[model samples]
Target: MVEPAHPKRRRAASWILAVVLAVFVTMGAVGCSPSLGSPPCMPPEYRVNPSSAKPGEAVTVSAPDATCNPRYGSNAQIRIVFTDAMGVEVLNTTAPMTDKGGFAFTTEVPTPTAVGEVAVYAAPEGVDWCDDTGTNNRAGSGEDELEMASCAKPMKPLTITK
Candidate 1:
């Protein structure tokens, strides 16, 4: 019988290659697992002045420059949504982008049947939620962040009182 040269080295190399292949396969499986959902979008620099306010009071909502992609240009607009504790749409308004790609608008707070706190968010008018494009269609891996679009975040909760 003819024996191969350096049998021990060949065996070790084969074993190592098998282990590496297995690890790669396992990683790919977990990364592409459908159990994971799209990763959360990156938070914007949204802010609500006077975090607390009364019904009908004027409050300013502003997002600093670079909050939203300026690529949208001058025509771009941001929708400022105010949702009450009950998940009610208390106020919804659109603010035009400033020269610096930032937005500032003042609007009166709306009265909701149940008012303890209200969440203020500024969403880019034409932006979409982040989605996973991986084979498994899962998002939890955070790879979505690289391709994510603008995402709104809750500013300091606005308190509403009688």
Candidate 2:
């Protein structure tokens, strides 16, 4: 006659099976799971309302209704660079991120040292959520790496009228 299985052996075998099943279930869930209603990743969008400002005038830079990839989520930071006609940096500031993943900043142009145009550039710094190349290259792929919402164009020429 065959001997019955020992109680201790049965219990231990059951526990091991349970642990293995749990691990398999977790892996399956992670592998085949779909994203549940997540926002699309997009490059940070920015715009300076006028795109041009006179010396001593206050200009508003806006990052409106923007979305970042779920990978980055809401951990992105925006920076604005204001440069003069001679490519001299005038103002560099970090704008505050909004609840909707947007930002806005207001800065006054400094008195002109000389009469010429000033250029402004808005870009996103830190992690980039808009990257979709799947290479996970957040540094960007050249000039296209960062989003250029609006350029100063010719930037407004400053005139020192006495």
Candidate 3:
């Protein structure tokens, strides 16, 4: 006659299986699983043509790889901002994201009092929802934007030459 397994052993094995299953489920949920209906989280990129420019010169800034799906959803606008070395907002404008989440616009470089470097930053504004980060906090709480929007601020370096 064969002996039956001990009650304690059976309970331990069941507990271990439960824990392992839970871990796998959590991992899949957190992982970047495209099948889970979550788009890959990619920071919107900024592109500057003629990166180095003289004051009053026309410069074009574009973001051709920005996407709003699975986070901001449709009907989101990407705002382009130009800030001087002193952190002063010199120019600001908004562009509608294309179906492919890209936009292009031209603006004259701001002629600051002194010739210095100006930074170009872009972020999605007026988003419908913002996703929680690894820390479980709202991601996009900032000035002039939705509190829950993802604050993926991609920047481009620009030099103002004399």
Candidate 4:
């Protein structure tokens, strides 16, 4: 006949099994789970040298380096738009993501055909919500625009002139 297992031995075996199971669960969670969402994107700092320009003149808009989704998302892009007085998009360019988590972009102003009080606007790509009629929008051409309502500081739309 087999002797009954000792109480202390049984407890020890149970404790070891519990520990092993816990380790597996923890490991799986750490290795398999996607990263938690990163902090919201910082409002890009934008500047244009020679704030005023004539139609077809080259202007430069430079802003300090920044991150969109930081390390959490790929395919992140920044779009810089130049709008003429007629509220028409004259130049719109999308910059590619850099290998590092940050992206600092500088581009020469696109030449405008319409001229007269041109403005520069910058934004992250792939946004769907745009309000042209609502008060939550910028005054520009008919393009749909999303109001970045929750930024730490209200972003002033950059502008240039002819």
Candidate 5:
């Protein structure tokens, strides 16, 4: 006949199994912790001081509310486009993010001798959370085009007279 396990051995084996299970549970909890999720990602917030500027004037474009999704860190690029009333692009500048997780650009309205309006546009280089895709991806990534609402607005008309 087969001998049954001793009571002391059985108790020790049960304790070992319990400890192993506890360790596994603890590890799983840690692996699935909130901290393990993507960092708090934040979309760029474009703000232009004065919002309207005359020719020969300078405007400040700042990203004050800019922040990286805490889980993803700050990894993004910025591009600024300046266009004239004729729908002709005059200036295009790309500024990379600094270690501070923010960026800014200063542009001067050109004093055109022609009468027309000027517009400035700020767009995130890649996907933007504010975009319809709801994820920060690069532009043309099958994602909706990301643009700054304020920047997309047409600028005040400037009358050029001899």
Candidate 6:
């Protein structure tokens, strides 16, 4: 075997790399942990003001801004959907994010003048849930945030009487 000339330098470089990786793991876990909630993994949430309103009344859908964490890819353009008591889609629109995560859109509640309940829910922005792009293919080990978000999230519900 040939003797290495810079063995000391090689060891020093390895030590530095290890330290750097350790720091990264500690600092990055806060944003990437599988846990869900605010300050970390705040899942997308939505609500409508005045749970009770008249038909065709003005209403606001809020998908409040969230922590732009790197681990959980919650970057989808939040979609605001208002449906009738029968679960029929009444109003459908996409809300734009103000800063990082949360989004909001204002719309009027619709109805057929039925004296029943109305519902408002949310979902990911795009129609197709599958991502074939290299950036979001959580098919195997070592998947990115965007890929993990491909799965559907529990839709937030808001009930308002008209």
**Candidate that scores best on TM-score:** 3
Off by over 4 Å in 2: 1-40, 67-76, 113-115, 128-132, 135-162
lDDT of 1 by residue, 1-162 (tens): 987779899999999999999986875555323344422332246778888878888899887775322344567677788888888887787889653347788988875525688878776665442333322212232243444435434456778877
User: Candidate 5 residues 1-162, lDDT tens each?
Assistant: 999999999999999999999986875555323443433244455666656666667777667543443222356566676677677776678776543336687766666623455566665565453433333333444666556533233233333222
TM-score of each: 0.55, 0.50, 0.59, 0.46, 0.47, 0.53
Residue-level lDDT of model 2, residues 49-160, one tens digit each, is: 5655567777777767544432323555566777676667777787766534477888777775234655566655654444444444244235444552342322323332
How far is each candidate from the true structure, as Cα RMSD in Å?
Answer: 9.7, 12.8, 6.5, 11.7, 10.8, 9.0
Superposition error at 8 for model 3 (Å): 21
| Worst 10 contiguous positions by lDDT, candidate 6 | 132-141
Order the candidate numbers by TM-score, best to worst.
3, 1, 6, 2, 5, 4
How much is 20 displaced in model 4, in angstroms?
30
TM-score of 4: 0.46
- What candidate 5 gets wrong by more than 4 Å, as runs, is 1-42, 65-76, 99-101, 113-117, 126-162
Number of the candidate with higher TM-score, 4 or 6: 6
Q: In order, what lDDT does every prediction score?
A: 0.64, 0.56, 0.66, 0.53, 0.55, 0.56
Best by lDDT: 3
TM-score of 3: 0.59
Worst 10 residues of 4 by lDDT: 129-138
Give the CA lDDT, 0 to 100, for residue 67 in model 1: 33
Better of 4 and 5 by lDDT: 5
Error of 1 at 7 (Å): 28
Off by over 4 Å in 4: 1-37, 67-69, 72-75, 97-112, 127-162
lDDT of 3 by residue, 73-157 (tens): 3465677888877788888888776544566778888776236778787766554323444322113446455454555545788
- Candidate 3 or 5, higher lDDT? 3
